[model samples]
Target: MDTAISPELATKAERDDLLTLGVEEEYLLVDAVEPRAAEAVDAVFAEVPGELRDGVQHEYYRTQIEVASPPQLELDELAAALLRLRSGVAAAAERAGVRLVAVGTAPATGQNARIVDNERYHRMRQRFGDLSPGQGMCGTHVHVSIPDPETGVRVLNHLRPWLPVLQAATANSPLFGGRDTGYASWRSMMWERWPTVGPTPYLRSHEHYLTLIGDLEASGAMLDAGMLYWYARLSATYPTVEIRMGDVMPTADDAVLLAALARALVGTLLHEVRAGIEAPDVEHPLLMAAHWRAAHDGLEGLNIDMATREPRPAWRLLRQLFDYVRPELERHGDLATVTALMGRLHEHGTGAARQRAMLASGASVGDVVDELARATRGEPGNPPID
Candidate 1:
């Protein structure tokens, strides 16, 4: 992999225009011994340290908790904050007599998640019907600062084709109902059952982007702008391009890897916009197929190459993505970190693969869940895969 910075960027001083980024990682609360999803979010939240409470919040379901990092300009700072918050939250779950596991979905058999006691959540359940109970699926969202809606929408266009590769790198949910689902990220498959969760359509301009959001809401396909769960979108509340393609990673380091790539991708797209480069007009159907393939295979098998419309080794496509964003990674002082993390991903495999390995090695589903809980707390007993 040739990751050298191009000569034009090399001659200039390292660009001072690094984008600010933040991460939101959702975690599942499970029984410490039985491996079932635990309805202990309220209990756990009460135990969170005062200093870390702001970053901790409840998810759509009581079985999950979400941690949001403050916007940061540096990757190391983000890493430190995420680690501190994750460790703190894990401690709180322990105090609450439950375990926090970062798997993408509940792995135990015959477990059902209950909605939190929020009016809006109840409305969602009433309207969405059967889809509400499966809301326990967890994902990681990366928000990278953008200058304006126009640039953010364009970045979404450029980001469309690469979303599957990102999803493949973060495919962590392989077990559910006490068995391997034969899919890398079953949470993604479950998520796509929602009306508005798939690839973002090609936008002609910023106006077109706004128009579509309104249309989707008016047509009842989405309840609100918040429900526009496209793989990438301009955040409704934040002035950032949000990438919602990956699963909740197993470790803080894994989340950091995702943030690094997402920020670099945005930076690369901003440069392209300035240089008058047009975003690719990738087909929507092909994009959807790619996402399915990614959730099925992860990095251990083949992924659809959008450019060739043929299957390629997922890792090679990942390399291509890394190469495409190399200049931005180099400019932002993230090259070494990304390189090392990617190596770690290569050696350890995705969380789904690791979980399956444990299951195959005579460990029961409950044992796997216990190990994941220990890994979530960064304890010495379990090796890290993030």
Candidate 2:
């Protein structure tokens, strides 16, 4: 698509410490009895404090709600802020006779469920019909702010190969449609039917991105730039690269770990680009293959090397990648927490693994929903919410 950035922009002197972080989490609003997204965010919003309420917004379906953390330099603080916001939202939902559950996809969603009736959502429904129905998927979005558009594009390009590893680490959806989907991350496969919703094509520059967006706009393939729902893409609105890979984490600790890894990777890639080293280019075809593996097997999948196009066990590749980015995580002060949780994720398995184990042992979807609710609330028995 000829997305090369101009030479002048690429050659400009790099800025120092060009990365900041933020997070966006989507949640399902469930009726206390059933684990499904509830159409009650508008009512719940009124109960949250104004200061803690600004960035909270509705999702494609009224049944889902989203909260965004303020931009922060400290990863731990960012995680805490998100947890606080989540707690507030949950409490408000409870007061309104609804509850909040954090998971990639709700177990009880169906085609008969209602979509948010806003102009934008209605337009999308009109355009895509049942393809864009209320799927009740929840996700955690990590934002790494770059110094400029060129750097954003560069970091986005370089990080494409490692996304599947991160996805495997955070795999949390083992059930969908009130039964086992038989995929580690059912959410990963669920969103692929949209026009531009998977791993994006590699772009060389900001201009290249502009051209692609321009083409999508000109061709009416998308309503505007906002509809280009790539799994990992450079944000046109915020000056950040958004990694929409992970599921809605099962616990706050898992969420923090995902954020730490993402920020470290972005920081390291930016450092490498500034040092005039060529960023590693993973084969796009291999990345697509690995993504499918991550969706099906989660941590158990055999990940293919993007450069060599050779298969390796997901655990082995994840550990190798962690070693390479460990320095960056250390420098950012997230090393200990990130490393600890990486081990925990491996030992306990991703959310998908945990959910599958729970179900196989006789827990129903309602039980899974209750567990997710407790995890989100930072209850005593559960791991601390991030």
Candidate 3:
């Protein structure tokens, strides 16, 4: 017997029929003059209008704020939303006498005066100890809708080896605690302290994924599905696979490029799964090491090649990644934009390299922040110097 779709199911099914995209970006609220982390997030939040209130949010730390975009179809639409959100949040923070800077970690490493006054956040601080308050990092998260949990799991499985490639392209945080951490993404170092924050091994089926989540809940490391903080996971709140790698990019262009790559990767992997392609048999340790290399070296030196599991220059890996997903990009009409962004990233270096270059040339931490601030406002900050 053939089954017919219910009206409700049809309505819900329509949403996942196409690949919709969403973005979540986090920013650090800092003292306008001294560039120290400031506790003015509350005031800044108050300035957001109620109509624009749904997307603007306070994060785990008092000095942090986050904004999310609604589902979008075109890359330009998402880009516009991000720009508006950045400017909106920037205006509010400015009114509060603080500036909104888009780096992964706080420039000053001093302890936060207070965490977000939420029960869950408080519990996280208690559970994680010093790791919670010590972190002031932010990230750019992209959510791409999948037809179902089964497909979502498959997408995550195939995405494992490539997450580090995305991380390297978006590595912007090279400084933390008023000093060079000597790694491109110091925030990632702080983030991995949580027991559940890195990439996960393959889940052969959706049932296996649910079973694993149940086990994690039984172990009490996580309160719920929301706490399943893999680098990429099926979003509990949306019918989407959220790719949560990469630092929060300083400019809207970089953020949109990340989103496009994420969507293309998910779409390509989903098609491969439907075509009966097997997911890569990658070991979990290898994935973790790949992530570590990208975090430590960014894109300037070497990175782990997902195809061969061998060391290669970061740029070569990035090029290989683009080739892997070229078909999907062409399908979505994003190849040109993605290619242009790739060229720009390679030419200018990853965000971490750009930040280091400024600092290396006698630019103070304040100068670095100023340049990042300029980029956040859609102005071309300092270009990559030779």
Best by lDDT: 1
Question: After aligning candidate 2 to the native by TM-score, how far in Å is the CA of 203 from where it should be?
Answer: 0.9
What is the lDDT for 101 in model 2? 82
Clashing pairs in 3: none
Q: Which sections of candidate 3 miss by over 4 Å?
A: 1-17
**Residue-by-residue lDDT tens digits, candidate 1, 66-160:** 99888776789888888888899999998999889999988887457788999878877777887745528999999988888998888888898
User: Compared with the true structure, what per-residue lDDT tens digits does model 3 show for residues 193-225?
Assistant: 877799966898899999989998888777778
Q: Between prediction 2 and prediction 3, which has the larger lDDT?
A: 3
The model with the greater lDDT, 1 or 3, is 1
Ranking of candidates on TM-score, top first: 1, 3, 2
Writing each residue's lDDT as its tens digit, candidate 2 over 346-371 gives: 77777887777777777778888887
123 Cα displacement, candidate 2 (Å): 1.3
Better of 2 and 3 by TM-score: 3
What's the candidate order when arranged by decreasing lDDT?
1, 3, 2
Tell me how far the alpha carbon of residue 236 in candidate 2 is from the true structure, in angstroms, after superposition: 2.2
Judging by TM-score against the true structure, name the best candidate: 1
